[model samples]
Target: MARVAYTTPEGRARRDQLVRAAMQAFAQRGYHGVTMDTIAAEVGVTRQGLLHHFPSKVDLLVAVLERRDEDDSELLSTLRAREDTPLAEILRAVLRHNAQRPGLAALFTILSAESVDPEHPAHDWFADRYRRGRILVAEWIAAEQARGRITSAATPQRLATSVLALLDGLQLQQQLEDEPLDIDGVLAELLALLR
Candidate 1:
């Protein structure tokens, strides 16, 4: 399918609409389970219309993931810019934000698990996301240690890995629990050990 230029306001809006529809569909059904036709129908577009904005299902998936990451990166950048904000608090805020958008959280949880197979379309994306996330978080931890805000007992890399693991685990648990998990409180208590 030839990609259409989403340069105009209406075109961009249409593209965004398709991405949102795809995200929700992919979240409700696993990526493999969702079809481009389903997303097009949800967005009130024809398959060809959806394809104009996204050449393939994988392309649409990439846009969905990128949109999620863009929002998160923006939030992280804003929180990290505050000199007084600690890493734990920043992370807690992010968790709180994710809690508010359960679909997005579910999307991440489901996709991350499904993408474990090397043959999965998102396998490389998830792998690279974790690698980059670990590195970025490790840098934050190292900087905090240098500033004497967190304990230096453990290497930044190890702490970063643990932090990411905790976040991922908590998100999965949150999805399963009958009662909502206290994500904020949990992060605060566990993360305090590092301070």
Candidate 2:
């Protein structure tokens, strides 16, 4: 297997630049809107050069999603600021985080529809995302339950599934309609239910 050139500082920076350009393409044209030719041109690189980095569109999309995770990792710091309401803080942070990355969300917005099919590259991407998301939510729910802040009857896994479902449903609404979706309000409602 050919080694990906992500180890060097310059290589990493270049990779990030390509991912950002890919994100712009994702926002403007969605998943299908972007092509290898387009992304290569977007980065002012030759198609061959682009392929040298990302051999396929799936690779690039995976990188974009990974970039989202990396960017969202910054939300981790915000979680530390509030010790008492970690779950609430996480929900709020997720809201605030996506609010900043509408393009990233838009990327997701476009891809998620087609992601349902097993053939789609985005399918596994989203599945993995849901798994990780559920684990995080479950962890916080478990903590809250242990502290008697939440109901003991509600299993953390079940609550996590519900929370993630709400987030997905809300995002779907936001994408389908032209009106501005009340992300914070939706999160607040879900948070209240958790309590």
Candidate 3:
């Protein structure tokens, strides 16, 4: 039977620690490169110990993604609450925030590519996330157009798709290349084009 330590506060903390370690390992090494042993060694635990919290590598990855979603949701809510900030500026702030989180950025880059295979563990999750993201961005763009902040020459859906593509490409490039990204400047130029 699996150990029940994860039910207690200490156990939950330990589990969270394992998730953090796994995220770092997975970020540094692609999914195929890291194993249960690598993750357990990160936290000074045996493979069996890690298994007590996450029975399989897939489970660990899912847990890490879920934690990331929770964090991102909270951050997005806080950012959205800045009523004085325009959506464009809010998006630029998000990009700046992403640049500061290299580990998470790398994780997203690696996982997104891996999940393109329909058989991959996170394929559906990534697909759903992208679909929802595109929808939300499209809605935002349409609203901006209605307010006359954005030009109506292009469809909102197309603009949203382009914006998301730029964001993803920028994130990947920022990680793959050691060069610093001028996200704010790039975003400003894009927003200008939209206007």
Candidate 4:
């Protein structure tokens, strides 16, 4: 059988389907627990077919993470385009979006914890992700501070670190609680503290 180029529309759609299946599987069971065979079955593809798209489980995991980040970055970019939008509101929008997609949230939370070991395939990816996130957020905080929008005496780097930590903790807590946590409210309070 001829292999379809991933650049083709059909190939791209098939690849997306496989990634979504893998994301759900990885979210429910950590990366180690999920098998390529299982993801292939969930997407109605043969093992070879899945391999043709992803090459390996790690590749599939990367695709899943990239897709999640692309979605989040798109949202952030849209919100950030509004110059008047507060940093806290931008973050609240992100949290609200994550709450709507619990599977993605769970996938991030689970993988981030699991990939902390240096031996894990995704350890470097997660490390770089956090590093880049902190840098971008710190820059934004500094810009806000310069605009006199953020009144906090704390340095932008420290504030960025705290914000990222709070967001991660809130996401984990939101997943663990049976009752829905008011994530937006909590974030609002934290941002207020920064102000």
Candidate 5:
């Protein structure tokens, strides 16, 4: 249970603290393992204080996932801005970013399992998210094709779907506990196959 902080700058900072704490709890402990009290304690706040911002665990989970998505989107755009050439570099940047977000891996793992059932609240989010990601990646692939850097054989849509599948599957593997996952090596191999 993370404390509910207000939406002011200071409050947002506080809320961010709570979100991070809750993310850790949810990730390391899983969704059912976390309690509001545990989250509040992690953030050094009373349950009531936490409830002020997020009234339920479900709400907190949604917020954590949403913020994580927003942050990742910004980071990806930043990476794109830093280097638009060398498609491999762009893919590597995104892979490295995902490795850095341990909590997002856990959230994604749970979401993936739940999303298959159509009844899950996160189903629509994941569905729409993948669609958007595929579109963006396809556009990027088309651009690279236009630039003649990439071989203009496969259609951009097919390449984009493959790339997105790799990302999701890689993250899924990484979320496993006590499993040896070589995400970097896998990304390198995939980068070689990107063309």
Candidate 6:
């Protein structure tokens, strides 16, 4: 008999379900702390069933990361496509969106910190992610500079690196503290410095 493909809506939903459950588990436990069995149980699926979608725990982590990135990319492309949208405003919007998804923020923070070990499955992936993220943000900053919306005093490369660092730091703080973060005010201050 021919093998059944898990490409239908049902299959995709199941896969998303597994990814969401895995994100929650990974956020709470970190990559090394969670197991394939735990993720499967969270999703109410057998280990074999979960494996059918994600062959390994590493694959699941990658999926969660990729899903988060895709969502951000889509949101940026869709909502902030206007040339009039300042990069600072875009950054603020992204911060707001992230605040609404604290679980994802936690997952990113925990995995990124733990993935520093060369032997970790997500080490290379996280490295590439940071590299690409910096480049993309630098390009955006350069564009804004060209448009004369941002100050030209700083190089785009430096500005982009700082922006990424600030974002990561903010996420870490939000995750570590129970008090609500003044994301908008903090982002406004950063934007002011950039301007």
Report each candidate's C-alpha RMSD, comma-separated, in the order given: 1.9, 2.9, 2.1, 2.7, 3.6, 3.0
lDDT of candidates 1 onward, in order: 0.86, 0.79, 0.83, 0.86, 0.77, 0.83
Residues 80-193 of candidate 5: C-alpha lDDT, one tens digit per residue: 786456766677777777677766767667766667778765678788888988898888888888877677987889888988888778777766646758777877776667
Please provide TM-scores, in order, for all candidate models, with all chains considered together.
0.90, 0.80, 0.92, 0.90, 0.78, 0.86
Clashing pairs in 2: none
Candidate 3 residue-wise lDDT at 33: 80
Candidate 6 backbone collisions, by pair? none
State the lDDT of candidate 3 residue by residue for 12-99, as single tens digits. 8989899999898888886778999988988999989888888898888888789879978987798768745555886887787777
Whole-model lDDT, model 1: 0.86
Q: Which stretches in model 3 have alpha-carbon errors above 4 Å?
A: 1-5
Worst 10 residues of 3 by lDDT: 1-10
Best by TM-score: 3
Question: Can you tell me which runs of candidate 1 are displaced by over 4 Å?
Answer: none
lDDT for 113 (candidate 3): 90
lDDT of 5 at 169: 80
- The worst-scoring run of ten residues by lDDT in candidate 1 lies at 1-10
Residue-level lDDT tens digits of model 4 in 55-158: 88888877887887789788878887887777887788778788788888899999999999998888998999889989988988988888777885879888
For model 6, residues 25-131, the per-residue Cα lDDT tens digits are 88899999999998888888998998788888778877887887798788768655676778888787778788888888888888888999999888988899889
Candidate 5 lDDT = 0.77
The total of clashing pairs for model 3 equals 0
Scored against the true structure, residue 174 in model 2 reaches a CA lDDT of 77
Report the candidate with higher lDDT, 2 versus 3.
3
Cand. 2 TM to true fold: 0.80
